[model samples]
Target: MPTYRAPRGTRDLLPTETPTWTRLERLAADLAARYGYRRIETPLFEQTDVFERGIGEVTDVVEKELFRLAPRTEESESWVLRPEPTAGIVRAYVQHGMRTWPQPVKVTQTGPMFRYDRPQAGRYRQFWQFDVEAIGDPGPAVDAEIIELGTRFYREAGLDGVEVLLNSIGDAACRPAYVAELTAYYEPHRVALPAIERGRLDRNVLRLLDSKDPAMAGLNANAPRMTERLCADCAEHFAAVRAHLDALGVGYRLEPGLVRGLDYYTRTAFEFYLVGREGQQQAIGGGGRYDGLVELLGGRPTPAIGFGIGLDRLILALTETAQAVPSEAGPTAVVVGADPDDTIARLRVVTQLRAAGVGSRAELGRRKLGKQLEAAARDGAHFAVILGDELADGNVGLRDLPAGTQKVVALADLAREIERAHAAHRHGGGPD
Candidate 1:
């Protein structure tokens, strides 16, 4: 016999871990909705061009991380599981005839994403994210609003001190000259550069600066800062974004060399890192102003900005909060039957209770009544509706685990009785 396993780089999120994910997503959705952002969903797999065109064909995501699928037919273009949600969201924005809607159409989404990257701690091939996009409008104010909103998500999750590392790669007007300067600075030390990084230097020079490679650290640190070379318009936009964040009292550090690897990011690029992660900064989420993305993907010349929050790391950071709080983990009752032949009837009762909006578990075994009751208690079940020969009397035994008490309630009154017992339990009247 062999043990079947979930494919590498993926793991199941079991029932016990779901409450945390739910609470985090609910908070994100509520916060996004409060900002007038509506929920939007896109296909899990899309034409490869959706990402290739949006994020740039040379980027790591498209070059190496993509999980491309074979074309179903010759007429069909290739598809890939979404490595990130932004491209799909933007495609939806264009394909769904959103042009007639209000300007800067704000949308938020949370779902799984696939990336065939090496699995490490806090990184997975299949992961989930909370994504937000402000399409059709571009303003420093909205940029600040998005950054503040990202920070607020952490606060709402009961974790704070998330520091924002922000920078400006400038726009087309200034980035070209800056990239030339960056390339020149690195080209001299090309021998010192790792072969992989040297490849990025000639093509996307800024990517080398964003590298985590130990060898390139010195080259990047000594390179020129794009902030010093920003066009007047970009400079003003950056200033206004900072001013808006200041007005909102959001804290952020200006990192001149910090640039998102994605090519679409323009002017403002930022990442949110856990400041208190034991002195190690781990980015939880980040986004930037991509003013040219909408137009590049065939839409009218529209400006947009958005962010993607990594949910796996987020849940890890907020796990303690979930533990401290009491949540409705599982069902409150288990309909346990004493007779082996009572399985169907027991299940029927379970269904009836559930249909009436009372959640419960079902144990349809002929195990001893005491053993079934003990299992229910171990699961923290508040009630156990024990069915037996006495069920013929139009009554069922309802035992309150906390109170160590039991009562025979009429079948017709079972739902009402369960509600009353649970309410009492909530009101602190049930036994400890």
Candidate 2:
């Protein structure tokens, strides 16, 4: 026989860790709802072309991280475990004709997404994302609203010291000319660019603007900035987004070199990071404008903006800041000192407690009264109900473990008294 464990880059959230996830989900859901966003669900996998057309061909996700698989049928084409949810959500919107329902469709979802990347601390091959998207709006207010939602989400989740990095990649009209100028600037220093960056020089020159290699970073330091190339329309939109952020009192930094490293994003692109945690590999979450994505995915030209918060990274940030707390665990009630012959009575008590929505556990193995009390304390039980030959005389022993108090109550009034005590204890009104 062999012992098995969860695969690398994956984890099983045990009972002790469930409360963190539960708390985060609740906070995210409440924040999204307050912002007028509804919930949406999509499949875990989709046709390969969906991603190829939706996520850029030159992006790292498509080039290296996608989890590709073939369907069962011989004639069927390949499918991919969705590395992200935006494309799938767009596809659903188009397929369901959601365009006819409203001008801007607001939605959010939380689920597992797969990608084949080297797992490091806070990075995983399979992880959860809390994603929110707004489709069919091209206004700058929409962009600001999405960013605001993301900021509030982090604060609501108890994360502090987070900041936003904002930038505009320019609109379609101004981008081509800027791309040409950028290409020319890098042409002279092309030989100095890193091998990995050189390959993307011609195809995705903007990414070079974000190079981390010391050599490439030096070469790019003098390169022309994207802001210098923004067309009139893109410049106006960028200004409007900034105005909204300022009016709303949201502090942000203008990173001219902030290329989001994604293909579909245009005009507005931004990322959120925790201040003083710059060395952390992953951003807590980020999102930007993807106006052309829906059309590229075979739908109408629907403009949209959204963000995806990495649950793993967010948890890490929370831990580092000492904002996360472990959830308390215990059985609400324990049945103690039941003899083998008194099994029926013990079972009745256990069943009744459960039926009344109380969490109860019983001692099945034969044990002495003292041993039973020790077990109950070890399990963090609130109270112990003793059912033995002594309690067969129409009364039961109710022991309050914490207070060292014990009393005998009529068997008929046992359940009612337990319920009252439990309620009082939960509300902090019970005796010490």
Candidate 3:
């Protein structure tokens, strides 16, 4: 028998590393809520057609990265491990009639997104995404607000050195013309294009504009710029979005070639990158306006714009910048030295602490007092309540590990004193 590890490209978020994820998720959810976005959870899997139609046929996500599953029984239907939540969320909106309730329904979600990608550094087969989507409104203000929300999320999470690169892909009114021009531009250089670039020339012309191969860079440079070909309405919408961003003091660089790798996106397309990270894969978070996503999923043509911040990549950037900090693990009050004779008394105290919303764990393994304290420290506990033969006599010992302070208090008042200390610590009152 051999010790097995996590499957390649997958990782186990152990206790020590869980705080980072927890803090990031909490910050994202809080920011989303502050922006009037409610939380919505969808299934881990959805119908295969939803992604195929929504993500675009020529995109790499659909053409290569999707995880398709066949039914076990003959009569069962086909399903796919959802590659993204936007399509499923749109499906739910249509199926449940969210359109009738209000205009511009704001929603956010945080979960694992499965993709059959070739696992590499900063890329995983199963990764978590904190996604936020605004449905129904087509106003440029909505786009600006979503981008601002994403900026706030990263700032709050302490992910510095991020830059927002923005662009407008125009709307259906102007995209077709640009496609034709782009196709013609690449026609002459078709022989010089990479295999993937050549394959995408007819089916997905926009992708050719962003090919990473050195040979295709020259061809891309000569291609038409999307901003110049924007329709009147799209041009006005994009101008308004830029104006709003300027008014709010949100810094962004105009990226003419930033037609995000998705079909549903229209008008505004933006990506937030961590500067000085790995080349090309420096994107920590990105999103854009998807005005036709809802309709594609069978709903009314509701407009939406949202972003999914990559938790892993953001943490990696934090690490690279040496800005990563150990998030405060919530207080864990340890009950030490539980004797068999006074087990009931010790259990009662533990239950009381827990009932009061304090995370109190009892020493069930019958370890020595020194070992118990060590265990508490290892578990990131700030304080330990020693309940031995001496303390069992109406008094409890409160050991503050960081301060090297010990005090004896009445058993009835122990929980209150510990809570007050925890509160003060939480409010930045103590040395540690």
All candidates: TM-score? 0.91, 0.93, 0.91
Candidate 1 global lDDT: 0.86
Q: Give the higher-lDDT candidate: 2 or 3.
A: 2
**Candidate 1 per-residue C-alpha lDDT over 1-432 given as tens digits, one digit per residue, 9 for 90 to 100:** 559988889999887778778888899999999999999989999989989999899888899999899887999888999999888888887888798898979999999999998988778999999999999877999999999999998888888667899998899899999888888888888887788898887778887877878877776787788988899999999999999999999999998768787889999999999875753228889899898888888888788899999999887766644532436455778898777567898898999899888989888777777788888888888888988878899889898887789999998899889988797777974443
lDDT score, candidate 1, position 157: 83
Worst 10 residues of 2 by lDDT: 337-346
- Give the root-mean-square deviation of each candidate in angstroms: 2.7, 2.2, 2.5
Error of 2 at 411 (Å): 3.5
User: What lDDT score is found at residue 410 in candidate 2?
Assistant: 75
Candidate 1 residue 256 Cα shift, in angstroms, is 1.2
Name the candidate that leads on lDDT: 1
- Candidate 2 local lDDT, 313-374, one digit each (tens): 89888877777776566787788765644666777877877877778887766767788889
Question: Quick one: ranking by lDDT, best first?
Answer: 1, 2, 3
Quick one: best TM-score, which candidate? Answer: 2
Ranking under TM-score, best-scoring first? 2, 3, 1
